[model samples]
Target: MLFEDPVFASRMLSLLTLSIHAIFATLGVGLPLMIIIAHWLGIKKNDEHYLLMARRWARGFVVLVAVGVVTGTAIALQLALLWPNFMEMAGHVIALPLFMEVFAFFFEAIFLGIYLYTWNRFDDQRKHLLLLIPVAIGATMSAFFITTVNGFMNAPTGFQIIGGQMTGVSPIEAMFNPATPTKAAHVISTAFMTSAFVLAALAAYRLLKGAQHVYYKKALHLMMVVGLIFAIATAVIGDFAGKYLAKHQPEKLAAAEWHFETMEGAPLVLFGILDDEQNVRFGLEIPYALSILAHNHPQAEVIGLNEFPQEWHPPLFIHYLFDLMVIIGVWLVLFSFVYWWGMRRKWTIVTSRWFRRLIVASGPLAMLAIQAGWWMTEFGRQPWILRGVMTVEEAATQSPYVGHLFFFFLALYLILVIGVVVVLRNINQRFPLEQDLAHEGGERPWIT
Candidate 1:
């Protein structure tokens, strides 16, 4: 990275920071809702399995929340430190949401601490369950507020530049930028989808390891149900994302589809290689798909990369990132459908060891899909750090220590990851299922 162009090195380091932070951020936002729902079900159904399930999830989440706090803090600082110029402008118009997110984070942290220690402290289960609502709301609002800043970047509104200063600022308008709803909803749904699958993967691994207990079965069922619901929601919101891009950020939509020429009925190119001749080679083209994606009409005229100068054009390689994201989304949908069908039909194949292993694999694959979507979004905005308002070169910090800072943060993230794994493993070992089962006076390690 030191040998690379300074601007390019800074961009790569920012990408690394965001990529790592996203892992915990995704879980942090999604898991609170899951935990609360699981707890609610435990009381409603009078089921001890769900009661233990929720408790276990909550215990593991404490560690993740701490990691999220550290990474979240690191990212907040990195924005100002690495992109001083952009932050300078943003501090005037978009600062409201950024500041609001801190309050939201504190809200979440306070309730989470209360929720953890107060577990099983209430005779009225509903009273204890009520405590989780703020935790869930705070987690979601934290993501929402932060995404508003990003939405402002994509479609910068409620402010203007005059005499090299941002003027006419309206923080509310900027916070609710055109891209905010779609992007925020998309982020949230995918986070839920990814988190569900990750927990499902853990349950599947347990089931595959010959733990045929009803506890594991119940856990797997809950995660899969949640995964399937959010998977569908993610797909629906993704379509809205396409429409949003086509209308406001058409160049991004065009590049993702590899549509080079502006025309009606433009075919959507999937998995294509671009040649110097401006032709896409050896990839599938779904006729009129791009037009339909853009306008919900097959004959709608869609914008294309040809409309923009080559220098202004985003790198064509982001098309693959777009493709990877879509392909993984489709895979999760279909894979979940099969799991649903097999469960209904009582198919032995779905219960086979290989099928359970597939469930385990889906967890990481879902996370990768998330990574792909984010990369495509950031890369597609290339040349511009804030769309048309600012370029990356202008926004990057001129600090001489960017390389050193990158290494320090990189080492910190590595240590944090190792700590999370070791701590979670220890938690799991310390609170084995037999301890939970002992309270119920049920057969310990009983097979279903």
Candidate 2:
């Protein structure tokens, strides 16, 4: 017989899977653009070092893609088994994107194989680079379609729930819901930003370990530029996301800001602890900042938690997730900006051992920020699996097996992580940077 109290177990299992899957999925979405650019640069400059960077990144990306596919499949299964009610209802109005995502995944997979194996088949490296265009497109589209489903959950438009049945369904409207553009853009931009920093961290570590090479410098510089561009885009889109919350999901916005009273000229709370009584403690209070962020006007009215029932309020701790994401976004902007400027000024500080340590640290921090942002989004929508439509309790599976399944998947993720580390370490050992450089003047078997 199925257990009735499986909501918590199911929720935890899904959270664990998504969190682990995030690492590989983020790279799958972002690494292709970088690979294509690096390959293009290699061809343009006729530089063996750049070619080596592209080849190395591509090989590692293949491993990530494999693991990502496995975890992605796990997510797919969990959606049907764990949230059958939500899917059954959503399948009527929001199934288009979910169906399209499968095609997108295959498109990406097909081109990735072609790109990987045909590295040296064409005389023109540019022609080889051309194959990655489809790969990038497929990866980007996959993220786009999946995010649209998330967007629909947030907005829940395109259909009417009449007598507990969906009516007036329009899949197109659900796909083009108000939340899709900002959410999709933000997800893509941050994925690119996080991936760049992770790769840049590798280069920084190389330099820190006394690996004296111009290749690391070039690699770091390229990633810094890419990181800077996308980081700025993330901030801009994040602002739009704020505006979206204020207009469409005011309760979530209110909870994230610790706004307890609905009023104009609201203050923004920064890094505060919520007391047992729900009061802000030790927070930096910026007068009218919340109003401005929500409505582009300092005097505009901002909603608050009091506007909804106590049960409707999301956890107050999510404010920390919101703050962490903002802080990290700003930090990366400053870090990448200063690095790029320092290079232009030819300052020794830019290449200092301590500075490289900071660079190595930034990569993990960027990913940490990504997790915080995603958590903030998911947690802010508390109680409701689809805002105003279905509660999590209503959507979660009644199966007792969820608890056991969580442990099983947790072990699977650990094994996958160990396998990836072993494979990547072996690849690095088998084809060291110095070894590749030594053979640059001769026939390059590494190309195959």
Candidate 3:
């Protein structure tokens, strides 16, 4: 029945677009901070290497932001075209944050252009680097506003709905809903971690290829430190997020852990296959772990999906996705610690063949973890687009052509992906390496 539904087709299309957009969006959010920091370091050390790295990275950041904008615009259009009913009803309530995000986007774009264009124009390094402050803030604020809007969707507050109509709107309350803090922190932290790992991974790859230049090594070290900190922070913040879910959306918590029966001392299902008979097949669960994790006590009661109607239960497959995210997160933490330990001992961990392989793999693993985390959050909220307010079916457009549009968008996304990859590869090839520029006395040829 789901396969035959146009709503399902539209939902899938929208999810596809969002997932692809998320890659660029996370980079867009994270790269600015790194760029600004690199510029600061350059100014502090009076080292041309750091400045060159920052400028080179900024060019790539510009490309990512440009692509992000296009994909982001596509998502906005999809929301209206695919789920008009939901947008029409709640648009006003969510509009404030969305509008703020647009302003943030514009702000980021304006400064980014100026920062990129004026790389060598200002002789004062401090003055040149100052432009990146607003660029970083604007990029981060864009993520904050958009994430708050999503948080509102999960928690749904600041308004009264009667007979399918909203009234007594409080934009401030909606913007800073109960879920805002945890969700915003988690999202932003992951962005930083993702970007750091990605950059580190690329640099590590080059290192393994015999490009053992100081510039690459420095970049790798900087990104690794930042990535490790955020990776550890994400795990801790994730626990807080879990607790929030247990209190606010117990059914989602149940589904996430695959707890089918309501009882005390709920075991945490680590890996399981849920079946039609409400049993976990070939499952591995830790006794009382769910209770302790959710409420910090082994005896605490954890609600289960059976307590809610069949339609209210979230998809069970999200359990595996949640598990995958946790597993990868733990791996990142351990890997970071090992890398740090090696660094402390003055070991050439970055050049080690096996370690380099792991480092290169870290980027894709982090990306997967971020995607999985989102899958759990979005899919775990399933059947309802606005939590208790509206079912996805109620919000989805009633159009027979959605399936066709889905294919069209799929093709378009493929093209966008190819274009981005080619463009980024070209940029990397054209950009001068630190060794290449050292002979020129640290002068950048690209800067006019």
Every model: Cα RMSD to truth: 2.9, 1.8, 1.8
Task: Sort by lDDT, best first.
Answer: 2, 3, 1
lDDT-best of 1 and 3: 3
Model 2, span 175-286: residue lDDT tens: 9999999999999999899999999999999988888889988999999899999999999999999999999989899989999999999999999787878788899999
In candidate 1, what are the lDDT values of residues 144-173, reduced to their tens digit? 999888888788889889988889999999
Model 3 scores a TM of: 0.96
Error of 1 at 361 (Å): 1.0
Evaluated against the true structure, the overall lDDT of model 1 is 0.87
Cα lDDT tens digits, model 3, 304-385, are: 8899998998998899899999999999999987888889887886458889889999999999998999889999999999
Model 2 clashing residue pairs (backbone): none
Candidate whose TM-score is highest: 2
Per-model C-alpha lDDT, please?
0.87, 0.90, 0.88
For candidate 2, what is the lDDT? 0.90
The candidates, ranked best first by TM-score, are 2, 1, 3
Model 2 sits at a Cα RMSD from the real structure of 1.8
